[model samples]
Target: MHDATEATTTPKSDDELKELVSLARLVAYARENARDLNAEFSAYCLDLAFGALIQDLDRSGVSLSHESGQDSSLFGTRH
Candidate 1:
């Protein structure tokens, strides 16, 4: 379970790097306005963020649900 060469591997891809940067920014933003983020506002933000993420996944050809599952109507149509 130890490989020295593996530790020296190349950096992450552009997409991965961008995702990290985005997460860092989001964290920093939340920290900057700690008190302003109340429970209701946080819940709204989470819903919007997750909805956008699901939409992006659909656009990228990723399906979140199957045709014969109980959670089929949870996400609605791909579009």
Candidate 2:
């Protein structure tokens, strides 16, 4: 039910292309690793990606709850 023209259309912007590439990589990784429903594996992959993002943000000096010593939005309180 999908259109061939739509499938062949280019991404609108660099941001869109990056998002697509990231999603494709995630999907490929999931397919290769998560053979079943594998909730634990999925959660591990999500956590790994999130930790990488946090590291990137930290390198860019983009603080979350780290400066305020408060609970993070996703992970809750830090030790």
Global lDDT scores for all candidate models: 0.45, 0.46
lDDT at position 34, candidate 2: 50
Per-residue lDDT over 1-79 for candidate 2, one digit per residue giving the tens place of the 0 to 100 score: 6374653453345565455445434543453355345677676775466555444334434443433532133233222
Model 1: which residue pairs collide? none
The superposed Cα distance between candidate 1 and the true structure at residue 52, in angstroms, equals 0.2
Query: lDDT tens string, model 1, 1-75?
Result: 637455235344668545644543354344334435565666556545554544443444444432344222443
Highest TM-score scorer: 2
Clashing residue pairs found in predicted model 2 = none
